[model samples]
Each structure stands twice: as C-alpha cells, then as structure tokens.
Target: MWHGDRNGHGEGGGRGSAQGWCALALLHGKIEAHLERELQGAHGLSVREYSLLDVLSRQNSGEGGHLRMGEVAEAVVLSQSATTRLVTRLEDRGLLSRYLCATDRRGIYTDVTRAGLELLERARPTNDAALSEALDAAEGRPELASLVAVVRAL
Candidate 1:
C-alpha cells in the first residue's frame, strides 16, 4: 500500500492529513515516471506528446482528424502557447499538420497525420500497461483509491 500506518489521530489529524497528501504526491510521481519511461521506449513519445496525439486521434468530427488548438490545450492542461510549440514540433516530425480555421481565422486546427496515428497506436499498449500497473497498485489501498477518485472526478 502506498500509505503507511495512519498515525492514530482520528479524523482531524493523521489519515487525511499531511501523510496522505505526501503519499498521493509520491504515487502520482511514480505513475508519471513509469508512463514517461514506457512511452519513450515503446514509441519515442513523451507522455505530453503522446497525450497530444491521443487528443487529435480521438477527435470524431470535422475535416481530417482535427481539433482546435485551444480545445486541445485545455484538454491536455497545457498553455495555448505551449500547445502551439508542441504542435510545431509534431508538424516538423511529420506526425501532424496544422491549418488555420476557416471560420475563425485566428484559430488553428491540428490533425494527426498517418505517422502520428501509427505512433499513437504503437504506444497504446505501453500506455495501457502503465495504467494497469498504477491501478493495481492503487486498488486495494483506501487512501490511493480516494486520491484517484478525486483526480478522476476533476
């Protein structure tokens, strides 16, 4: 279990206090590290890059496999400028293409190219495995479950 013995301080002090917060931080860090390693080894993608590709590939509407840059940035918790830079990197790698949104000229849309989709598909297994491992580690632990539920709810 990720959390240690609940220092016997009842509801006001121990279990739900500093120790719990620390445990949650540690677990989140571990999961991110595992994901970073797996994605890099399996498909040469960082976790952020894989997430961007995933956001593009999972889009179900409009011209190409595309989504507005702002929407993608919001979905991936990135700043718009950061997303723009990331998109540029992907564009350079031939993983994706960008176009100005016709109706909203200032807006940019990003679409996954064949290479991007291929990389995302290739990375899926590793991502799934990392998630499974993290879930397994969290499942039997009450504190971890609570933390996971909170994050998921967000």
Candidate 2:
C-alpha cells in the first residue's frame, strides 16, 4: 500500500523519510562499489584487506611488525571476529601471521610478513592512483573537507 502524499510531498512520512534513507544508502553503495572495483582490479585485495594492511604498515617498526589484533580491528573499523577472519585469509596467502601476545596470552597480535610488505608496496601505486582520482573528483569542494571533518568528529 502506498502511503505517500498524493502530491508526492512529505505528508505521510516520519522524521526519517524514505528519500533520506535512500540517499544515504546510495552514497554508501557508490563508495563501496568504487573501492571494491579499484581494489579488485588494481590490487588483489578488497577494501577491508587493504585497510588492514595499511594499518599494519603504518605501525611497522625497524625490528619486526607487530600490532594487537583488537587494536587493528578498531583502527580498521571491523569487528574483532571479522578481523580474525581477514587475518586468517591474509595468513593463508602468506601476507601476514598471527600469534599470542607475550604480555598477555589471552591477547593476540598480528605481524606483517615480508610477503605482506611486498604486497603493500605493489598495491601502493594503485591505491595512490585511486586516491588521486577521488581527490580530483572532490577538487575545489569544501564539502569534501567538511565531510571528512564530520566523520572524524564521530
């Protein structure tokens, strides 16, 4: 049954209307599709996998690569269980490894392998290209910066 206004106005909707929800859904879908296509075509990684690798690469030190699994999950905006699954997949592909935390056996840590570092290096150019395209699309638009600031505020 159609409960919308006869004149297609907001006469029959709640605070959060269908149009507003649809706009948000479309925005999310576009971003996800863009990232997915770029990652799959340019690098053999998905957005989630790339995000995990990026976080670990930033955390890398001179000696060895190590980051807490929970911390990585939080940084990458994934659930701990989902992060574990991603880590498992990366490990199977010789990209990373996981181990128990020395300080606390109950805690787990992840380390990027040499292969992982190599993959990150390989994917850098493609990621840079994608980011450049996205930035160019947002060029001269203050809304881009405003959107970033708003997300960061959250």
Q: TM-scores of the models, in the given order?
A: 0.75, 0.67
Flag regions of model 2 displaced more than 4 Å.
1-29, 60-66, 138-154
Angstrom error of the Cα, residue 132, model 1: value is 1.0
Query: How far does residue 74 in candidate 1 sit from its true spot (Å)?
Result: 1.4
Candidate 1 local lDDT, 12-116, one digit each (tens): 657567778887887787778889988898788898999999988888665654567778999888999999999899899999998787778997778899989
Would you list the clashing residue pairs of candidate 2? Answer: none
Specify the poorest-scoring 10-residue window by lDDT in model 2. 143-152
Best by TM-score: 1
For each candidate, the alpha-carbon lDDT, in order, equals 0.82, 0.74
Model 2 score (lDDT): 0.74
Q: Write one digit per residue (lDDT tens) for candidate 2, span 7-119.
A: 56554574346555664454445555667688889778998898898898787544445667778889999998999999999999999887786768997778788999988
